[model samples]
Target: MVEPGPSISILAGGVTALFAVFLTFYLRNQWQEIQSLRAIQTELEQNNERVRELAQLLTGDLQRQQIDLPIEVPPGTKLEIRYVVSFPSSLSTTAFDQLKHSGMFLRLSPETRRSLFELYDTIDRINRLRQHRERIHFDDIGNVHVVIDPSELDVEPDASVSEDDLSAETRRRLSDLREMRRAMKGVNRSILRLIASIASPEMIDDLELEPFLGTAHGREAGHESNTESPRSDEVDLEEMRSILRDVERESVWSRFM
Candidate 1:
């Protein structure tokens, strides 16, 4: 074969160098995309855990309310009602926001984009509801006194408080609690479904997010396995009453009184 000319050789070298530069940029973009996906996956896992904990607490309270059980206060306790609301950790949207604005995410299938947007929207709704519930508990209902007479101990306080005796504010508060529990259940289901969808083989492959998807799938499986047995809403009313009675005789209660 004849030797190539100098101009042709220089042109070939230029093309090779240009291709290398393009490849470097392409690889860098892919690396950043993977990092963002991983961060989003981690946040999703942490948020799911917080949702589970909140759901459990709400379930217990809802069960007690449904059964018309008293707040487990002893008779003549003269206790002050303190509404201590423990808020869950806020869900991080940093990675999700970044991905949504990125070109890579924009190139994703429209269906996938819609699904992601819906998931984030639902999370936003849950966060807003949580803040509203906290405001109702802390600002609206602050601290109320539960002045229990010694004679009232023989009968359940809930039983003694007639419908006519319940103030409008009390009724509103009860309604708010029930609504919050329902909202929480909805949020829990939505989150679980989102996790399952993102961890599916097709979605994982399309997103090129193997490791993050694997971790998410594992966490989802663990949660489902642990919850295989349905939790009974029923609680031991007598046991709760006894515990409260014991607390009444304790030095802490006496000091507060």
Candidate 2:
């Protein structure tokens, strides 16, 4: 019954040991990555908190001064500001244009202000939904495929016959490999989600909501963090306006404007 050059169990043991080593190294690296990401996320949250504080301070200063010393305007204050905010071609950019064109930023009547705020809140909800969809899922599939080099293996006819005898070990190793692949996929998904969340096209419209995205603090934080640039999600509002103004002078938007 034992017609084999090498003992089946012995070979199986060796393969199992090799698989264990690979899995151990892979898991160790994954744990380190997760730890690193957690730290970066914490720092990002702290930076965001600081940004909120800055916004509050600026708002308070404006409010306090407004009450004590009202702003002086000329006899007929018919002020009109026109500008463009350049954005990368993305769904978020389209959404931002739509919202801006909707007169959301204009000084509207009291009823319109309430409606704009509601619309703003709805946009936020949509953004959150998109982020949630981007999260890691265990069963997720990727388009990229990995090809194993079967030519690297030196297989003898006898080795092939004994493979069935070591079926238990083979099954175990294969299962472990499958699990490892799944775990790695999850990690990759999470990383992609984080990147997407920071630079997601859907978040473009949020820039015009209340607190502008990519402020000085955000830019500094982006430079400090390895994760994302501070202006990763924002359209350069002022710069866009300047470019459009120049374009207008060149008669680019003459037909529309």
Candidate 3:
């Protein structure tokens, strides 16, 4: 039942106008902030896309033009590879025949070649040790060191009374060493075969490689010009092997234990 006074009405109208003005300013500020956030989000997405495009250029894709390598492997060492739906299990028998026939070993960068050679050397050493153990006579061999020669021992002459007794064992070790050498040669050939396979399209099945290749091959349009395809010579074999070893160990070995 209170009657409105003129001064009170005028004061109420002024307060109401001030509230509306404040509300309008607040809404405009919020809108501008939203617009700024949208622009920043758009820029980030564009940057991410640019990064992806650059990565694609480093690796090649099967659908795009392929580069031929100059390396030629000797005969009989070639592999016959086939697509295996279940890999790692089929890796042993299913020859990547296409890769072997392609002579892609010629495409191995110097780094990859070095890694392959090192792997071959390790295989050789391990095989030689195995062979030497197989050929030894139980009595003639002393220490279990598979490839050690008794004559090479720095021990004093008094350590052994007889020299002729070791001749047979020594000869056996020599035979083992020769056989090991041959087996190692075969292993080196096998590693070369693996490199040849990787150099070809078979490498796409590996993890991260597809994305890496996709980004490297420049398969898409409207991408920034910064993307560069990695030539065969540019790949760091050591780094690739380290990554592959980790992936294999994580995927293959961890399952059994």
- Top of the candidates by lDDT: 1
Give the poorly placed runs of model 1, Cα more than 4 Å off. 1-13, 64-82, 143-257
- Backbone atom clashes (below 3 Å) for every candidate: 0, 1, 18
Off by over 4 Å in 2: 1-9, 61-257
Q: Per-residue lDDT tens digits of candidate 2, residues 1-257?
A: 78575688789899999999999886665444333323333433443343233323323323332212222223223222111112111112223334334322242346433433433333343334334323322124322222222222233333322223334544354344344444443232332223323332333343222332342335423433242223243322222233333433444223332
In candidate 1, what are the lDDT values of residues 150-254, reduced to their tens digit? 343445544444333444665466555455444444334333333333233443354333332222345434553232211222112222223323433442323
Question: Quick one: ranking by lDDT, best first?
Answer: 1, 3, 2
Identify the runs in model 3 with alpha carbons over 4 angstroms from their true place: 1-4, 60-257
What is each predicted model's overall lDDT from 0 to 1?
Answer: 0.47, 0.34, 0.35
Candidate no. 3 TM-score: 0.24
Model 2, 2: alpha-carbon shift in Å? Answer: 14
- What's every prediction's RMSD, in angstroms? 19.2, 36.3, 23.9
**Model 3, span 90-184: residue lDDT tens:** 11111222222322333445665465444333323323433332333222332223232334544444444122333466446544434443333
lDDT of 3 at 138: 28
Residue pairs with clashing backbones, model 1: none
